[model samples]
Target: MNPDATTTGADAIDEAIASGNDFDGSPIPQAKLGLYHQVMGLEAGRQRSGVSNTMRSRIVRIGAKHIPQAELNQMLVDADFAPLKDKEIAFYYSGK
Candidate 1:
């Protein structure tokens, strides 16, 4: 895939959760939550810049080879909550 393509972190995570595969439709391993986290975290960090081509490519290859549907779904939920939890903690601390 073109590195220049506009692929956001949310886009990648959503695709992984919804499709159980990478954007190219290759299956992702459920065990590679770390990879997903890294990719998603990068996306979150950038906010608007999106996933870099290098990271996107890595995610595609790793996901295609490893993740399963059910695990991917759970990971998706975890991934979704992680940022929220972080925000909650931040807000809590800020009020102190």
Candidate 2:
């Protein structure tokens, strides 16, 4: 597996995700949004392979750039995710 592609632990996952204003709160930077998209895309593939929720968040936090890991987690939680599952999360990244 690619070093950039891996999973994390539970607490770490929860720490990265946000829990306010739906989807990491508004006002996401465009460039970071793009990075979030890329990181998430990679995460989606890993989710398929059985990585833990925390692991997923950690990977994006340490390896990728877009969408701050905390925000991503917050977004996921906002979307009603209590744990990591093999499902895609949506982030309407506006180029603001």
Candidate 3:
């Protein structure tokens, strides 16, 4: 598939872009693309512990830098909110 190439077919390009990219808020930097998995793990840790130790971990950034802008601008919602362990289920919502 040639991303930069233009085709004259309805199926040529997915209209998903019209729906708006949910992950646009965050974009994996070229240098950090390889660390996407590790960054995801860090997000999980933050969600669980409610405390971010990114500065110490050095594995991922704590704020926007930690998240790819494409992801952050889209479906991804960044937050430091903590879940109560006592609660069986917790939900967090983010929107523009």
Candidate 4:
């Protein structure tokens, strides 16, 4: 994938979410968008002590939805990120 296409796919999704429209240009329901913004606003204000930790958090938050657990783990390892912790695995992969 082109690295500069637009940060990451998650970033694009976030932009769409913030715009209150889907990629197809349909309006997102106000209630749903408001709830999304409420939760994400809390996350945005969270304090982080390190860049790597923030990056890992984002990868885990977004990657879990699209990538398989084993694949995501390997991707993280390949990128020099710490492998998923047990709690992360349980939370991100359990339902899938």
Ranking under TM-score, best-scoring first?
A: 4, 2, 1, 3
Any idea what lDDT model 3 has? 0.36
Stretches off by above 4 angstroms in model 4 are 1-46
Report, for every candidate in turn, its global Cα lDDT versus the true structure: 0.50, 0.47, 0.36, 0.84
| Candidate 4 lDDT by residue in tens digits, 1-96 | 223335345478777776677766778999998888899889899887899998999899889988999999999999999998999999999998
lDDT of 1: 0.50
Best by TM-score: 4
The sequence of per-residue lDDT tens digits that candidate 1 reaches over residues 1-96 is 333433565476565655556656566677675687788888777745334544444443354345653453355456542222344334333343
Question: Comparing candidate 2 with candidate 3, which one achieves the higher TM-score?
Answer: 2
**lDDT of candidate 2 vs native?**
0.47
Candidate 2 minimal-lDDT segment of 10 residues: 14-23
- Listed in order, each prediction's TM-score against the native is 0.23, 0.25, 0.18, 0.58
> Candidate 2 has what TM-score?
0.25
Alpha-carbon runs more than 4 Å astray in model 2:
1-26, 47-96
Error of 2 at 54 (Å): 7.2
List pairs with backbone clashes in candidate 1: 27-64, 28-63, 28-67, 29-66, 29-67, 30-67, 30-68
Residue 4 local lDDT, model 4: 38
Please report, as a residue range, the 10-residue window in candidate 1 with the lowest summed lDDT. 80-89
Cα deviation of 7, candidate 4, in Å? 17
